[model samples]
Target: MIRTLTEKEIEISGEKKIYGTLARPASAYTDEKFPAVLMISGSGPLDRNGNGPKGKYQLNVYKELAEYITKLGFITFRYDKRGTGKSEGDWISTGMWDLVDDAELAFKFLQNHPQVDRDKIIVAGHSEGTIIGTALSERQELNGLMLLSGGVGNLHEFTTYQRMLTYQELKNSKGIKGLLMRLLINEEKAETKTQKQTKKIIESNKDVYKILFFFKQPAKWIREHFAYNPRVGLKKVTYPVIAIHGDKDGLVDPSLLEELSSLVKGPSETHIIKDMEHGFRFQYEQKSMVNVKKMLKVLPSRPLNPDSLGVIESWLTKYFKADVSSDIKENA
Candidate 1:
């Protein structure tokens, strides 16, 4: 039987009461302190189950994975990212560093839970969550990490590729992404005729300026992203890790999956699922929201990568099964 589990909204670090959920096998009891995972969302403000704005696809993914983990003898805690759903904050205001620290906080929170094995904590991150997951695990308290649809390339490069991929398809049409990128990157500032005017008016803020000045070409940020390198962060990940990539994923370069595994300095594994996309939806056709439509059609309970959930569940089990020891070598 699927147990509803426990949850509480916690206010941490900012003016946000993060919505958190803990799921376990129905057979579990207070005395049964089990291995638990802290689930973190990617770049956006996702709800407790991984859905966006107010969706449940992410929740489905987390629950299904948690169910499998529960059946395999584990528990899971998935939370709504700040600024989304029951959480407070504006998605636009937070950056990567802010996101990473939140995941770390989740870990710290889970550590105090009575039902969780204090030492058996795994941080599972999907897409952007992967980056935050890696950063958290590097701190040495987490049991391991699961990077789903994680990127091995740089953030700047990935953002550009994503924008271009979508832009190319809609290029002929006003190309809103391109227009927005231009507004953020160049044309608006160029139109202003001076950095002072550019600084005051361009809603992008000073961080954008620092990043732009890094390349000496604020307008050339696209170039930096086009060549963005995630190797720096990927290399920094030195914990028990698993990187999963869906064969059907159109957003990320699938070829980098193996490379990410090789780059990790610890116990690691990679599973490339045959027909999954960014949302873990099965391949239906190129660029169709039909998969999402099909997913949403599934209703109140949703599942992430319906076709590949087993792979994620299994890998998680194998990792948690690793012997725990502070004296153990940090690198597996």
Candidate 2:
């Protein structure tokens, strides 16, 4: 029988009181400890629930994964970053390292929880969270690591590729205005000329340029993100790792899975989910601006990719033994 899970709102004291939720099987006894999983949300101003205010997308992918994993007899902990959701701090001033530090604190918090088996802590990160998880694994002795939709290349190269893809999409959609704007802003021209063009664009189409290019992005965070190489952390991680990517992810290329798998020092596995998108939702159709817009509009009702969850569940069940009888047991 599927056991019900109980969730409790908790706080991790750090630079600030980080708000989080701890979930475990409802039937768990008071003295029973369970294997724990820490869920890290993707980049931007996303909350613990994995919901971002930007755009119309409301896919709570991390929250859904936490629920699913909890059902499989694991204690799950997920929280808002220092600057997002109920956590305290300014989102604009936080950089990649700051976020990593927050995650480290979250890891310790989970490790010390009364109902969690400290040695069985697994770190699962989505998108940019993968970088944080990798960094955490390097510092902490984690049972396993999960990377979902993470980039294989450095941040600068990934950003460039993403811009190229966006430009291509605009060109294919006959978006002459958007394409021209992207070219003018991104071209390696003289600084004075680029600044002049950027100012002119901002003056002419303030709303569109802001929404398309600079919307909700903080300068400090972007600069740090571009400088850090995720592979550096991935290489340092010695724990068992699994990297999963959606075949149709437009943001990060799926081919990076091979590169990521090669860097792991421990047992590593990679899977590419067909028909899945960057948000871990199944989309059988190929890329198109209209389809993208439609997907965004329907994100609130979209379901998590069952195949992706199956891969994760199987990996966790294989690598880490859940304490089934005494509340938790190591997989032998």
Candidate 3:
């Protein structure tokens, strides 16, 4: 039998109105409630469809994942971050906890859906969402969690490690750019400047901070995230968890998958796919944040890595098969 999907544009009321799309199997099952997945996007001014501002970034990772999982008989909800898309508030001023609140509200929206199985709801987060979902799991009892491109460290520690890797790559560059960088940039001074900037942000009381007297950043958000330790909440997560990272994911260390999985008190699994980047697409070239903009320009054209999707399918089936209704399972 061919499976069809029913999608609806919905809103969840909270401190601010949250806009999102919910997709579910269209099969008739009046007395049955299907398992559901709430998707939390990575850090960015991203929309419900996972596109960035004015189509500058069009990696539709969450949208594709939601559609794929919905086809597998699960209802999936992906919402816009505050101040982005049709959602309310200022993204630049929104703190990390605010994102968590929005996610919780999205979860409650799923739980309250007539066709959703309250006990079978799962939260799947990518990159930044991984930590947010972990934090949410501490607040809500989720059936399962899927952490993509994220591991078990605070943002501060992770960013410092990423800087080190980028520095090493730049230090080894083989041309004029390398010569100029080495001549003009002192690693020790760079580190000191970064430390000073971080200290300023942490001590600031402003919601937004101006850098270079022009560029604005979400100071409160950075402050909150830098201090957040996912280990505390992850250690309390007794629910099944599956973490997937790409071997080429430059933003988050893929090797941390082992530590992340081990922290979960419940059954857990991890996968590190080759050539896959943080965006879930395959990138055969050297992956670096320095070339992120250039890479993102081509990422939307590339399809998601088959192995990553397969792992998600396999893990969900293994741990949450009972959550799917009989008719939906039959179709699968």
Q: All models: lDDT?
A: 0.59, 0.75, 0.85
Give the Cα RMSD of candidate 1.
8.9
- Please list the residue runs of candidate 3 whose C-alpha ends up more than 4 Å from where it truly belongs after superposition: 322-332
Question: Runs in model 2 with CA error above 4 Å?
Answer: 54-56, 174-217, 288-294, 326-332
lDDT of 2 by residue, 1-332 (tens): 13568899988887777898888876635878888999888877788888865533567777888898887889999998777778998766677777888888988988888888887899988888887787777677888888888755655565555756765666455467666755655434544554564444434422123435555435456556666777887777677888888877777766677786678788999998988887888877775433566777675576878999899888988888675663332221
lDDT of 3 at 211: 81
lDDT of 3: 0.85
Candidate 2 clashes between residue pairs 3 or more apart in a chain or in different chains: 321-331, 322-329, 323-328, 323-329
Q: Which ten residues in a row have the lowest lDDT in candidate 1?
A: 322-331
Model 1 C-alpha lDDT per residue in residues 186-220, reported as the tens digit of each score: 43344445445333324443323443444322322
lDDT of 3 at 139: 93
Reference-based TM-score of each model = 0.69, 0.83, 0.95
- Clash counts per candidate, in order, are 10, 4, 0
Q: Which parts of model 1 have CA positions greater than 4 angstroms off? A: 1-15, 54-60, 164-230, 287-307, 322-332
Kindly provide the TM-score of model 3 when superposed on the true structure, using C-alpha atoms.
0.95
lDDT of 2 at 319: 82
